[model samples]
Target: MRKLVIAISMLAFTGAAASADPIADRQALMKERGKLVGTLSKVVKGEQAFDAAAVLDALKGLEANAEKFDTEALFPVGSEQGRDTTAAPKIWEDKAGFNAAEDKFLADVKAAVAAPPADVDALKGPFGTIAKDCGACHQTYRIKKG
Candidate 1:
């Protein structure tokens, strides 16, 4: 019983500590976001023939990713300093502006999901919009590591 208690406690502690690392969490979130975009980009570029269902699936995944991106929890103060984070100091300096950018990301993703594209041509505009949104945010809020 004592051993079981100790193991459980250790697991709980480690889980909490891991989850509390906002920098790592945010990085993972951003990576997932990028991957979803890549998937959609392939369809947009005609690298993959567009299947309406698959396109919708990727867009839905994007919506889910955006929903999970909580700036407050993911970008906590001081989280930009470690784990090779690229977050710009302006994120903290202009919290409102940063949040507005995040909000726009989520809202645009949701719009894409709500009105999914029916063809590659249709996907192009939404994909372009998403790419632009990402680039704009990176330009304003991310420091290029390279």
Candidate 2:
């Protein structure tokens, strides 16, 4: 009886500590991405100094982080530590499509980041496309919290 109680307590504690909430985690990543977007925008719009090399550096971080959101990270269904999360319950029901969306978004960002525009004017179109893809994924997968 004492052993059972200890085991239950340990399981409960572990569950609470490890609830992944990937939706929340993704939102937090986006918040950081937002800052990068703003900085990129400033450079693109001619409002700030233009630095192609700096753009590349910032983009590398976004690319690395974004890669994590693919199939496993987003649909985290069978995971005990990770757990199914605030990402709409629909995600599990339609796994393939969700993963495809992630793949497309990842591919788009990779191409966009690989070749940043030369001047502010040139950056606008590509930046907009990149941001739009981000919006697309968020809209489909993320649940609005009230």
Candidate 3:
């Protein structure tokens, strides 16, 4: 029950307001996504003890962030032109492909949440998958920024 409650509130915790400036909103969410991934990375690296509950919470956070990704709202036309945005022009040109990438990422996240690892060693495979999923999206839809 408590985990479910945490998962529910994960949206608010990760949300950066999808109201006005979507570029900012998506950027903020991505930053939070990094933090969530970092938490799991630590566990996977053996830097943190494996606590199933903690892993589940982090997984839930990923799930929340993935589920909240409103592509249409966040990637609106002209949004790709924002100076502060790292989104690639292909995001606009290849909207369907971008949407497909996002769908795969969200599905992978939900799958991790559904069958969360019981230990740190068990987490490596899923963690690798999640990392690859993010990389795939960025490769196609994001522009590198210094």
Top candidate when judged by lDDT against the true structure: 3
* All candidates: TM-score: 0.85, 0.65, 0.88
Q: What is the lDDT of residue 48 in candidate 3?
A: 93
* Model 1 residue 19 CA deviation in Å: 2.8
Sorted on lDDT, highest at the top, how do the candidates line up?
3, 1, 2
What candidate 2 gets wrong by more than 4 Å, as runs, is 1-28, 45-47, 78-86
C-alpha lDDT of residue 43 in model 2: 79
Kindly report the root-mean-square deviation of model 2 from the true structure over all alpha carbons. Answer: 11.7
Candidate 3: clashing residue pairs, number: 0
TM-score of 3: 0.88
Models sorted by TM-score, best on top? 3, 1, 2
**Predicted candidate 1 versus true structure: per-residue lDDT over 97-133, tens digit per residue:** 9888888888888888788898889888888888889
Clashes of 1: 0
lDDT of candidate 2 over 1-146, digit per residue (tens): 32443344345434433666554555455555666677777777778887766666555545654664545663466432243344665567777777877677677668877776676666777778877876776687666667
Off by over 4 Å in 1: 1-18
| Candidate that beats the other on TM-score, 2 or 3, i.e. the better one | 3
lDDT of 1 at 107: 84
